[model samples]
Target: MEQEQQTICPWCMTEIVWDEEIGPEKHCPHCDNELSGYRTLQIGLDQDDQAEDEDEEDTSDEPEWDAGDEDESYGGNGSAWKDTDQGFRHTNRAWMAVEETLRRVVDEQEEAPECPSCREYMIEAGKQKLNVEPTVHGAVGRPLVQSPIETTLYVCPSCFNTSSILSDKDRERMLKALSPQD
Candidate 1:
Protein backbone atom coordinates (compact mmCIF):
# COMPACT_ATOMS: atom_id res chain seq x y z
CA MET A 1 0.00 0.00 0.00
CA GLU A 2 1.23 3.46 -0.80
CA GLN A 3 1.93 5.68 2.16
CA GLU A 4 -0.35 8.62 2.64
CA GLN A 5 1.05 12.02 1.77
CA GLN A 6 1.39 14.30 4.78
CA THR A 7 1.02 18.07 4.93
CA ILE A 8 1.18 20.28 8.01
CA CYS A 9 -0.72 23.42 8.94
CA PRO A 10 1.61 26.39 9.14
CA TRP A 11 -0.41 27.90 11.93
CA CYS A 12 -1.28 24.94 14.12
CA MET A 13 1.35 22.57 12.77
CA THR A 14 -1.37 19.97 12.60
CA GLU A 15 -0.61 17.06 10.28
CA ILE A 16 -2.93 17.31 7.30
CA VAL A 17 -3.27 16.08 3.75
CA TRP A 18 -3.28 18.03 0.53
CA ASP A 19 -6.85 17.32 -0.31
CA GLU A 20 -7.34 18.98 -3.64
CA GLU A 21 -10.99 18.10 -3.38
CA ILE A 22 -11.17 20.54 -0.50
CA GLY A 23 -9.92 23.16 -2.95
CA PRO A 24 -8.11 26.38 -2.11
CA GLU A 25 -8.55 28.67 0.91
CA LYS A 26 -8.37 25.65 3.13
CA HIS A 27 -8.29 26.46 6.82
CA CYS A 28 -6.71 24.35 9.51
CA PRO A 29 -9.35 22.63 11.62
CA HIS A 30 -7.24 23.63 14.55
CA CYS A 31 -6.15 27.15 13.62
CA ASP A 32 -8.66 28.22 10.94
CA ASN A 33 -6.04 30.06 8.90
CA GLU A 34 -6.87 30.56 5.23
CA LEU A 35 -4.30 28.35 3.50
CA SER A 36 -3.20 27.93 -0.11
CA GLY A 37 -0.98 24.86 0.08
CA TYR A 38 2.22 26.82 0.69
CA ARG A 39 2.49 25.87 4.36
CA THR A 40 5.64 23.78 4.60
CA LEU A 41 6.53 22.63 8.07
CA GLN A 42 8.71 20.05 9.77
CA ILE A 43 6.97 18.91 12.93
CA GLY A 44 9.32 17.86 15.67
CA LEU A 45 8.55 14.37 16.96
CA ASP A 46 11.27 14.25 19.54
CA GLN A 47 10.79 12.56 22.90
CA ASP A 48 9.12 15.75 24.15
CA ASP A 49 6.61 15.45 21.31
CA GLN A 50 5.72 11.83 21.93
CA ALA A 51 2.89 12.56 24.33
CA GLU A 52 0.65 13.60 21.46
CA ASP A 53 1.45 10.36 19.65
CA GLU A 54 1.10 8.11 22.66
CA ASP A 55 -2.28 9.63 23.46
CA GLU A 56 -3.55 8.66 20.04
CA GLU A 57 -2.59 5.00 20.50
CA ASP A 58 -4.02 4.93 23.99
CA THR A 59 -7.50 6.14 23.20
CA SER A 60 -8.66 3.32 25.39
CA ASP A 61 -8.07 5.81 28.17
CA GLU A 62 -10.19 8.41 26.45
CA PRO A 63 -13.55 8.98 28.01
CA GLU A 64 -15.56 8.69 24.82
CA TRP A 65 -13.88 5.54 23.59
CA ASP A 66 -15.78 2.83 25.38
CA ALA A 67 -19.46 2.80 26.31
CA GLY A 68 -18.84 3.50 29.97
CA ASP A 69 -15.19 4.54 29.44
CA GLU A 70 -14.53 2.76 32.65
CA ASP A 71 -11.38 0.82 31.90
CA GLU A 72 -10.99 -1.29 35.00
CA SER A 73 -7.43 -2.07 33.96
CA TYR A 74 -6.40 1.51 34.54
CA GLY A 75 -5.30 2.22 38.09
CA GLY A 76 -5.74 5.91 37.43
CA ASN A 77 -7.64 8.10 39.85
CA GLY A 78 -10.40 8.43 37.27
CA SER A 79 -9.05 11.79 36.31
CA ALA A 80 -10.52 13.39 33.23
CA TRP A 81 -7.10 13.60 31.64
CA LYS A 82 -3.69 12.35 32.61
CA ASP A 83 -0.77 14.71 32.51
CA THR A 84 2.08 13.36 30.38
CA ASP A 85 4.61 15.77 31.88
CA GLN A 86 5.13 16.99 28.33
CA GLY A 87 3.38 20.30 28.93
CA PHE A 88 0.61 18.74 26.88
CA ARG A 89 -2.42 16.98 28.25
CA HIS A 90 -4.95 14.60 26.75
CA THR A 91 -8.47 15.44 27.74
CA ASN A 92 -12.04 15.68 26.54
CA ARG A 93 -12.78 19.36 26.53
CA ALA A 94 -15.77 21.10 25.06
CA TRP A 95 -15.42 22.00 21.40
CA MET A 96 -14.87 25.66 22.21
CA ALA A 97 -12.29 24.86 24.88
CA VAL A 98 -10.53 22.52 22.48
CA GLU A 99 -10.36 25.23 19.85
CA GLU A 100 -9.02 27.81 22.28
CA THR A 101 -6.54 25.39 23.82
CA LEU A 102 -5.38 24.22 20.40
CA ARG A 103 -4.79 27.79 19.28
CA ARG A 104 -2.78 28.56 22.39
CA VAL A 105 -0.74 25.37 22.06
CA VAL A 106 -0.07 25.87 18.35
CA ASP A 107 0.88 29.53 18.70
CA GLU A 108 3.39 28.51 21.36
CA GLN A 109 4.71 25.48 19.50
CA GLU A 110 4.84 26.54 15.83
CA GLU A 111 8.06 28.13 14.66
CA ALA A 112 7.70 31.62 13.21
CA PRO A 113 10.78 32.45 11.11
CA GLU A 114 11.01 35.23 8.57
CA CYS A 115 11.86 38.87 8.26
CA PRO A 116 8.46 40.51 8.39
CA SER A 117 9.53 43.22 5.94
CA CYS A 118 11.89 41.40 3.55
CA ARG A 119 10.27 38.05 4.16
CA GLU A 120 13.78 36.63 4.37
CA TYR A 121 15.81 34.97 7.11
CA MET A 122 17.70 38.17 7.81
CA ILE A 123 16.36 38.67 11.33
CA GLU A 124 15.07 36.75 14.33
CA ALA A 125 13.38 37.80 17.55
CA GLY A 126 10.58 37.02 19.94
CA LYS A 127 7.13 38.53 19.43
CA GLN A 128 7.42 40.86 22.40
CA LYS A 129 8.19 44.53 21.82
CA LEU A 130 10.82 46.27 23.94
CA ASN A 131 11.62 49.95 24.41
CA VAL A 132 15.02 51.22 25.49
CA GLU A 133 16.64 54.54 26.25
CA PRO A 134 19.55 55.11 23.92
CA THR A 135 21.59 56.90 26.59
CA VAL A 136 21.59 57.98 30.20
CA HIS A 137 23.25 60.81 32.15
CA GLY A 138 25.41 59.55 35.00
CA ALA A 139 25.06 60.98 38.54
CA VAL A 140 28.18 63.17 38.00
CA GLY A 141 26.57 64.57 34.81
CA ARG A 142 28.72 62.33 32.57
CA PRO A 143 26.80 61.23 29.50
CA LEU A 144 26.54 57.49 28.85
CA VAL A 145 25.96 56.56 25.21
CA GLN A 146 24.62 53.12 25.80
CA SER A 147 23.07 51.00 28.52
CA PRO A 148 22.15 47.40 29.25
CA ILE A 149 18.85 47.78 27.44
CA GLU A 150 16.39 45.43 25.83
CA THR A 151 16.31 45.53 22.02
CA THR A 152 13.76 42.85 21.29
CA LEU A 153 16.75 41.40 19.51
CA TYR A 154 17.25 37.73 18.95
CA VAL A 155 20.61 36.31 18.00
CA CYS A 156 21.12 34.36 14.81
CA PRO A 157 22.95 31.25 15.95
CA SER A 158 24.70 31.06 12.59
CA CYS A 159 26.22 34.56 12.62
CA PHE A 160 26.13 35.05 16.38
CA ASN A 161 24.62 38.47 15.71
CA THR A 162 21.44 39.93 17.16
CA SER A 163 18.60 41.36 15.07
CA SER A 164 14.95 42.19 15.34
CA ILE A 165 12.14 40.81 13.25
CA LEU A 166 11.58 43.35 10.52
CA SER A 167 9.64 46.28 11.88
CA ASP A 168 8.91 49.72 10.41
CA LYS A 169 12.20 50.97 11.83
CA ASP A 170 14.02 47.93 10.54
CA ARG A 171 12.44 48.35 7.12
CA GLU A 172 13.89 51.84 6.90
CA ARG A 173 17.24 50.45 7.98
CA MET A 174 17.03 47.80 5.25
CA LEU A 175 16.31 50.49 2.65
CA LYS A 176 19.31 52.50 3.90
CA ALA A 177 21.44 49.35 3.78
CA LEU A 178 20.29 48.67 0.21
CA SER A 179 20.87 52.24 -1.02
CA PRO A 180 24.61 52.05 -0.37
CA GLN A 181 24.84 48.77 -2.33
CA ASP A 182 22.66 50.10 -5.12
Candidate 2:
Protein backbone atom coordinates (compact mmCIF):
# COMPACT_ATOMS: atom_id res chain seq x y z
CA MET A 1 0.00 0.00 0.00
CA GLU A 2 1.25 3.46 -0.83
CA GLN A 3 1.61 5.86 2.06
CA GLU A 4 0.08 9.32 1.94
CA GLN A 5 2.52 12.21 1.61
CA GLN A 6 2.77 14.57 4.58
CA THR A 7 4.60 17.75 5.49
CA ILE A 8 4.87 20.21 8.36
CA CYS A 9 3.72 23.76 7.78
CA PRO A 10 6.50 26.37 7.92
CA TRP A 11 4.38 28.91 9.75
CA CYS A 12 2.32 26.82 12.20
CA MET A 13 4.27 23.53 12.27
CA THR A 14 1.09 21.58 11.68
CA GLU A 15 1.46 18.15 10.13
CA ILE A 16 -0.54 18.12 6.94
CA VAL A 17 -1.26 15.54 4.30
CA TRP A 18 0.31 16.83 1.11
CA ASP A 19 -2.26 16.75 -1.63
CA GLU A 20 -2.00 17.96 -5.20
CA GLU A 21 -5.77 18.25 -5.31
CA ILE A 22 -5.35 21.62 -3.57
CA GLY A 23 -2.79 22.60 -6.25
CA PRO A 24 0.65 24.21 -5.67
CA GLU A 25 -0.76 27.59 -4.73
CA LYS A 26 -2.56 26.00 -1.78
CA HIS A 27 -2.21 27.48 1.68
CA CYS A 28 -1.79 25.52 4.86
CA PRO A 29 -5.26 24.56 6.02
CA HIS A 30 -4.44 25.07 9.68
CA CYS A 31 -2.60 28.41 9.59
CA ASP A 32 -3.44 29.53 6.06
CA ASN A 33 0.26 30.22 5.45
CA GLU A 34 1.53 30.19 1.88
CA LEU A 35 3.00 26.91 0.64
CA SER A 36 4.66 28.32 -2.49
CA GLY A 37 8.32 28.21 -1.54
CA TYR A 38 8.00 25.59 1.19
CA ARG A 39 9.27 22.12 0.33
CA THR A 40 7.30 18.96 1.02
CA LEU A 41 8.63 17.02 4.01
CA GLN A 42 8.09 13.43 5.08
CA ILE A 43 9.37 11.31 7.90
CA GLY A 44 12.07 8.72 7.02
CA LEU A 45 12.29 9.93 3.46
CA ASP A 46 15.64 9.65 1.73
CA GLN A 47 17.06 12.75 0.08
CA ASP A 48 20.48 13.40 -1.52
CA ASP A 49 23.10 15.14 0.66
CA GLN A 50 22.56 18.32 -1.33
CA ALA A 51 18.79 18.12 -0.82
CA GLU A 52 19.35 17.65 2.92
CA ASP A 53 21.53 20.75 3.03
CA GLU A 54 18.91 22.64 1.07
CA ASP A 55 16.23 21.53 3.53
CA GLU A 56 18.30 22.81 6.43
CA GLU A 57 18.79 26.14 4.69
CA ASP A 58 15.04 26.41 4.02
CA THR A 59 14.23 25.73 7.65
CA SER A 60 15.76 28.21 10.09
CA ASP A 61 14.54 29.39 13.45
CA GLU A 62 11.50 27.16 13.09
CA PRO A 63 9.66 26.09 16.24
CA GLU A 64 10.99 22.58 16.61
CA TRP A 65 8.85 19.78 17.95
CA ASP A 66 9.32 19.61 21.71
CA ALA A 67 11.87 16.95 22.65
CA GLY A 68 9.22 15.40 24.93
CA ASP A 69 6.71 15.20 22.13
CA GLU A 70 9.17 13.80 19.57
CA ASP A 71 9.01 10.25 20.92
CA GLU A 72 5.27 10.16 21.49
CA SER A 73 2.30 10.42 19.16
CA TYR A 74 -0.86 12.46 19.66
CA GLY A 75 0.66 14.63 22.40
CA GLY A 76 1.87 11.47 24.27
CA ASN A 77 -1.69 10.68 25.26
CA GLY A 78 -2.23 7.73 22.89
CA SER A 79 -5.36 9.43 21.71
CA ALA A 80 -6.68 8.70 18.21
CA TRP A 81 -9.77 9.48 16.24
CA LYS A 82 -11.52 7.07 13.90
CA ASP A 83 -13.77 8.15 11.12
CA THR A 84 -16.82 5.95 11.22
CA ASP A 85 -19.40 5.95 8.46
CA GLN A 86 -21.66 7.63 10.95
CA GLY A 87 -19.15 10.36 11.77
CA PHE A 88 -16.09 10.31 14.06
CA ARG A 89 -15.35 8.60 17.34
CA HIS A 90 -12.60 8.98 19.93
CA THR A 91 -11.01 6.25 21.97
CA ASN A 92 -11.83 7.71 25.40
CA ARG A 93 -12.52 10.84 27.44
CA ALA A 94 -8.84 11.21 28.29
CA TRP A 95 -8.13 11.29 24.56
CA MET A 96 -10.63 14.10 24.17
CA ALA A 97 -8.93 16.11 26.89
CA VAL A 98 -5.55 15.45 25.31
CA GLU A 99 -6.83 16.52 21.91
CA GLU A 100 -8.24 19.74 23.34
CA THR A 101 -4.99 20.49 25.16
CA LEU A 102 -2.99 19.83 22.01
CA ARG A 103 -5.20 22.17 20.03
CA ARG A 104 -4.78 24.92 22.60
CA VAL A 105 -1.02 24.45 22.68
CA VAL A 106 -0.75 24.68 18.90
CA ASP A 107 -2.91 27.79 18.90
CA GLU A 108 -0.65 29.37 21.50
CA GLN A 109 2.43 28.42 19.54
CA GLU A 110 1.11 30.24 16.48
CA GLU A 111 0.87 33.38 18.59
CA ALA A 112 4.66 33.11 19.20
CA PRO A 113 4.71 34.73 22.62
CA GLU A 114 8.30 35.41 23.72
CA CYS A 115 9.62 34.48 27.14
CA PRO A 116 10.77 37.45 29.21
CA SER A 117 13.99 35.82 30.37
CA CYS A 118 15.16 33.97 27.29
CA ARG A 119 13.44 35.98 24.55
CA GLU A 120 12.42 32.65 23.01
CA TYR A 121 8.96 31.37 22.27
CA MET A 122 7.32 30.12 25.44
CA ILE A 123 4.99 27.15 25.44
CA GLU A 124 2.15 26.75 27.89
CA ALA A 125 3.06 24.08 30.44
CA GLY A 126 -0.42 24.08 31.90
CA LYS A 127 -1.62 24.98 35.39
CA GLN A 128 0.48 24.50 38.53
CA LYS A 129 -0.34 24.48 42.24
CA LEU A 130 1.54 26.86 44.52
CA ASN A 131 1.22 26.87 48.30
CA VAL A 132 0.99 30.46 49.51
CA GLU A 133 0.76 31.74 53.09
CA PRO A 134 -1.29 34.71 54.18
CA THR A 135 0.98 37.73 54.54
CA VAL A 136 -1.23 40.00 56.68
CA HIS A 137 -3.24 37.56 58.80
CA GLY A 138 -0.73 34.73 58.95
CA ALA A 139 -2.11 31.86 61.05
CA VAL A 140 -3.68 34.04 63.73
CA GLY A 141 -7.21 34.74 62.42
CA ARG A 142 -7.98 32.49 59.48
CA PRO A 143 -8.29 28.79 60.09
CA LEU A 144 -7.21 28.05 56.57
CA VAL A 145 -3.83 29.68 56.70
CA GLN A 146 -2.13 28.22 53.67
CA SER A 147 -3.89 27.87 50.33
CA PRO A 148 -3.04 26.65 46.90
CA ILE A 149 -2.19 29.25 44.26
CA GLU A 150 -3.31 28.13 40.85
CA THR A 151 -1.34 29.74 38.05
CA THR A 152 -0.58 29.08 34.42
CA LEU A 153 3.05 28.22 33.72
CA TYR A 154 4.78 29.08 30.45
CA VAL A 155 8.08 27.37 29.73
CA CYS A 156 10.80 28.32 27.29
CA PRO A 157 11.17 25.38 24.93
CA SER A 158 14.78 26.33 24.22
CA CYS A 159 16.19 27.14 27.65
CA PHE A 160 13.77 25.02 29.71
CA ASN A 161 13.19 28.11 31.87
CA THR A 162 9.74 28.68 33.32
CA SER A 163 7.56 31.52 34.65
CA SER A 164 4.08 31.61 36.12
CA ILE A 165 1.45 34.32 36.23
CA LEU A 166 -1.79 34.21 38.14
CA SER A 167 -5.13 35.26 36.74
CA ASP A 168 -6.98 38.32 38.03
CA LYS A 169 -9.37 36.18 40.07
CA ASP A 170 -6.57 34.16 41.58
CA ARG A 171 -4.72 37.34 42.58
CA GLU A 172 -7.86 38.69 44.20
CA ARG A 173 -8.38 35.44 46.07
CA MET A 174 -4.82 35.47 47.34
CA LEU A 175 -5.19 39.04 48.54
CA LYS A 176 -8.47 38.26 50.25
CA ALA A 177 -6.91 35.30 51.96
CA LEU A 178 -4.10 37.50 53.22
CA SER A 179 -6.33 40.38 54.33
CA PRO A 180 -7.06 40.50 58.09
CA GLN A 181 -10.64 40.12 59.20
CA ASP A 182 -12.17 42.96 61.21
Candidate 3:
Protein backbone atom coordinates (compact mmCIF):
# COMPACT_ATOMS: atom_id res chain seq x y z
CA MET A 1 0.00 0.00 0.00
CA GLU A 2 1.28 3.43 -0.93
CA GLN A 3 1.04 6.10 1.75
CA GLU A 4 0.11 9.53 0.48
CA GLN A 5 2.02 12.42 1.99
CA GLN A 6 0.18 15.55 3.09
CA THR A 7 0.90 18.72 5.04
CA ILE A 8 -1.20 21.32 6.74
CA CYS A 9 -0.75 25.06 6.34
CA PRO A 10 0.03 26.62 9.69
CA TRP A 11 -1.87 29.79 8.94
CA CYS A 12 -5.01 28.22 7.54
CA MET A 13 -4.83 24.59 8.56
CA THR A 14 -5.58 23.50 5.02
CA GLU A 15 -4.24 20.13 3.95
CA ILE A 16 -1.79 20.36 1.09
CA VAL A 17 -0.30 17.62 -1.04
CA TRP A 18 3.32 17.40 0.03
CA ASP A 19 5.77 17.99 -2.81
CA GLU A 20 9.51 18.55 -2.68
CA GLU A 21 9.24 20.87 -5.64
CA ILE A 22 8.37 23.62 -3.17
CA GLY A 23 11.53 25.70 -2.89
CA PRO A 24 13.06 27.62 0.04
CA GLU A 25 10.44 30.28 -0.45
CA LYS A 26 8.02 27.40 0.10
CA HIS A 27 4.54 28.83 0.09
CA CYS A 28 1.33 27.01 0.72
CA PRO A 29 -0.59 26.44 -2.52
CA HIS A 30 -3.77 27.15 -0.60
CA CYS A 31 -2.69 30.04 1.61
CA ASP A 32 0.65 31.12 0.06
CA ASN A 33 2.27 31.19 3.50
CA GLU A 34 5.91 30.25 4.08
CA LEU A 35 6.34 26.64 5.18
CA SER A 36 10.09 26.47 5.62
CA GLY A 37 10.30 25.45 9.30
CA TYR A 38 6.70 24.48 9.86
CA ARG A 39 5.99 21.02 11.20
CA THR A 40 3.28 18.77 9.82
CA LEU A 41 0.24 18.15 12.03
CA GLN A 42 -1.91 15.04 12.08
CA ILE A 43 -5.59 15.31 11.29
CA GLY A 44 -8.05 12.61 12.24
CA LEU A 45 -11.75 11.86 12.57
CA ASP A 46 -11.36 12.36 16.31
CA GLN A 47 -14.29 14.72 16.83
CA ASP A 48 -16.87 12.19 15.76
CA ASP A 49 -15.08 9.41 17.55
CA GLN A 50 -14.98 11.39 20.76
CA ALA A 51 -18.64 12.24 20.43
CA GLU A 52 -19.50 8.55 20.02
CA ASP A 53 -17.39 7.69 23.04
CA GLU A 54 -19.23 10.20 25.19
CA ASP A 55 -22.58 8.86 24.00
CA GLU A 56 -21.57 5.35 25.04
CA GLU A 57 -20.65 6.46 28.56
CA ASP A 58 -23.12 5.71 31.40
CA THR A 59 -25.48 8.57 32.41
CA SER A 60 -28.06 6.87 34.58
CA ASP A 61 -28.04 9.72 37.16
CA GLU A 62 -29.41 12.27 34.65
CA PRO A 63 -33.11 12.96 35.02
CA GLU A 64 -35.34 12.26 32.03
CA TRP A 65 -37.88 14.93 31.06
CA ASP A 66 -41.57 14.13 30.69
CA ALA A 67 -44.31 16.07 28.86
CA GLY A 68 -45.20 19.40 30.61
CA ASP A 69 -42.08 19.05 32.72
CA GLU A 70 -40.92 22.51 31.71
CA ASP A 71 -44.15 24.14 32.90
CA GLU A 72 -44.04 22.23 36.17
CA SER A 73 -40.41 23.27 36.79
CA TYR A 74 -40.99 26.92 35.87
CA GLY A 75 -44.43 27.19 37.50
CA GLY A 76 -45.71 28.97 34.39
CA ASN A 77 -48.01 28.20 31.50
CA GLY A 78 -46.08 26.57 28.64
CA SER A 79 -48.78 27.58 26.18
CA ALA A 80 -47.99 31.24 26.95
CA TRP A 81 -44.88 31.00 24.78
CA LYS A 82 -46.40 28.86 22.04
CA ASP A 83 -50.00 28.06 21.18
CA THR A 84 -49.53 24.27 21.03
CA ASP A 85 -46.91 21.64 21.83
CA GLN A 86 -46.70 20.86 18.13
CA GLY A 87 -45.66 24.47 17.49
CA PHE A 88 -42.81 24.13 19.99
CA ARG A 89 -41.79 20.86 18.40
CA HIS A 90 -41.71 22.53 14.98
CA THR A 91 -39.57 25.36 16.34
CA ASN A 92 -37.19 22.88 17.92
CA ARG A 93 -36.91 21.06 14.60
CA ALA A 94 -36.19 24.30 12.79
CA TRP A 95 -33.47 25.20 15.31
CA MET A 96 -31.97 21.76 14.86
CA ALA A 97 -31.90 22.27 11.12
CA VAL A 98 -30.14 25.60 11.61
CA GLU A 99 -27.60 24.02 13.95
CA GLU A 100 -26.95 21.25 11.46
CA THR A 101 -26.37 23.80 8.70
CA LEU A 102 -23.89 25.67 10.91
CA ARG A 103 -22.05 22.43 11.65
CA ARG A 104 -21.86 21.65 7.94
CA VAL A 105 -20.45 25.08 7.19
CA VAL A 106 -17.74 24.66 9.81
CA ASP A 107 -16.89 21.20 8.47
CA GLU A 108 -16.62 22.62 4.98
CA GLN A 109 -14.24 25.28 6.23
CA GLU A 110 -12.10 22.63 7.88
CA GLU A 111 -11.81 20.80 4.56
CA ALA A 112 -11.66 23.87 2.31
CA PRO A 113 -8.56 24.51 0.23
CA GLU A 114 -6.45 27.44 1.48
CA CYS A 115 -6.12 30.65 -0.46
CA PRO A 116 -2.60 31.04 -1.83
CA SER A 117 -2.31 34.73 -1.02
CA CYS A 118 -4.47 35.27 2.06
CA ARG A 119 -3.89 32.04 3.97
CA GLU A 120 -7.62 31.69 4.36
CA TYR A 121 -10.11 29.11 3.14
CA MET A 122 -10.95 29.56 -0.50
CA ILE A 123 -14.33 28.94 -2.01
CA GLU A 124 -15.23 28.14 -5.60
CA ALA A 125 -16.36 31.45 -7.04
CA GLY A 126 -17.55 30.51 -10.51
CA LYS A 127 -16.59 29.17 -13.91
CA GLN A 128 -15.59 31.61 -16.62
CA LYS A 129 -14.56 31.35 -20.24
CA LEU A 130 -11.47 33.20 -21.41
CA ASN A 131 -11.81 33.65 -25.14
CA VAL A 132 -8.79 34.25 -27.31
CA GLU A 133 -10.07 35.57 -30.59
CA PRO A 134 -7.89 35.58 -33.65
CA THR A 135 -7.18 39.08 -34.93
CA VAL A 136 -8.60 39.75 -38.37
CA HIS A 137 -6.90 42.14 -40.82
CA GLY A 138 -9.94 43.20 -42.81
CA ALA A 139 -10.41 39.70 -44.27
CA VAL A 140 -13.37 39.34 -46.61
CA GLY A 141 -15.73 36.38 -45.84
CA ARG A 142 -13.19 34.52 -43.64
CA PRO A 143 -14.97 33.00 -40.71
CA LEU A 144 -13.93 34.45 -37.39
CA VAL A 145 -12.11 31.99 -35.17
CA GLN A 146 -11.79 32.14 -31.43
CA SER A 147 -10.68 29.68 -28.77
CA PRO A 148 -12.84 29.60 -25.67
CA ILE A 149 -10.84 28.53 -22.63
CA GLU A 150 -12.96 27.46 -19.73
CA THR A 151 -11.51 27.88 -16.28
CA THR A 152 -12.62 27.31 -12.73
CA LEU A 153 -12.09 30.18 -10.29
CA TYR A 154 -11.55 30.19 -6.54
CA VAL A 155 -11.61 33.18 -4.26
CA CYS A 156 -10.36 33.86 -0.77
CA PRO A 157 -13.07 35.15 1.49
CA SER A 158 -10.57 37.07 3.64
CA CYS A 159 -8.13 38.84 1.32
CA PHE A 160 -10.22 38.48 -1.82
CA ASN A 161 -7.34 36.71 -3.56
CA THR A 162 -8.61 35.02 -6.70
CA SER A 163 -7.10 32.13 -8.64
CA SER A 164 -8.18 30.53 -11.90
CA ILE A 165 -6.94 27.44 -13.64
CA LEU A 166 -8.03 25.29 -16.52
CA SER A 167 -8.86 21.64 -15.92
CA ASP A 168 -6.98 18.91 -17.78
CA LYS A 169 -9.91 18.30 -20.13
CA ASP A 170 -10.25 22.02 -20.72
CA ARG A 171 -6.55 22.30 -21.47
CA GLU A 172 -6.83 19.55 -24.08
CA ARG A 173 -9.80 21.27 -25.66
CA MET A 174 -8.00 24.61 -25.71
CA LEU A 175 -4.93 23.07 -27.28
CA LYS A 176 -6.99 21.39 -29.97
CA ALA A 177 -8.87 24.60 -30.65
CA LEU A 178 -5.65 26.63 -30.92
CA SER A 179 -3.79 24.14 -33.08
CA PRO A 180 -3.87 24.57 -36.86
CA GLN A 181 -6.75 22.66 -38.41
CA ASP A 182 -6.17 20.25 -41.28
Q: Which model scores highest in lDDT?
A: 2
Candidate 1 per-residue lDDT, tens place, 1-182, comes to 43455667776778876545554345776778765656465767576568778877877744665556565444344443343334565566687685575446435633435444444333334554454454433432432222322334544333445554445554564455444342
Instruction: Please identify model 1 stretches exceeding 4 Å from their true place.
Output: 1-164
Scored against the true structure, residue 175 in model 3 reaches a CA lDDT of: 65
Worst 10 residues of 1 by lDDT: 142-151
How many pairs of residues collide in model 3? 5
Which 10 consecutive residues of model 3 have the lowest summed lDDT? 137-146
Give the clash count for each candidate: 0, 0, 5
Query: How high is each candidate's TM-score?
Result: 0.19, 0.30, 0.29
The digit string of per-residue lDDT tens for model 3 on 30-106 reads 77778776768676776888867887785577567656557653346664556545444454788788667644664
Q: State model 3's lDDT.
A: 0.65
How far in Å is the alpha carbon of 177 misplaced in model 1?
2.5
Rank order by lDDT, top first? 2, 3, 1
lDDT of each: 0.51, 0.66, 0.65
Please tell me which model should have the higher TM-score, number 1 or number 3.
3
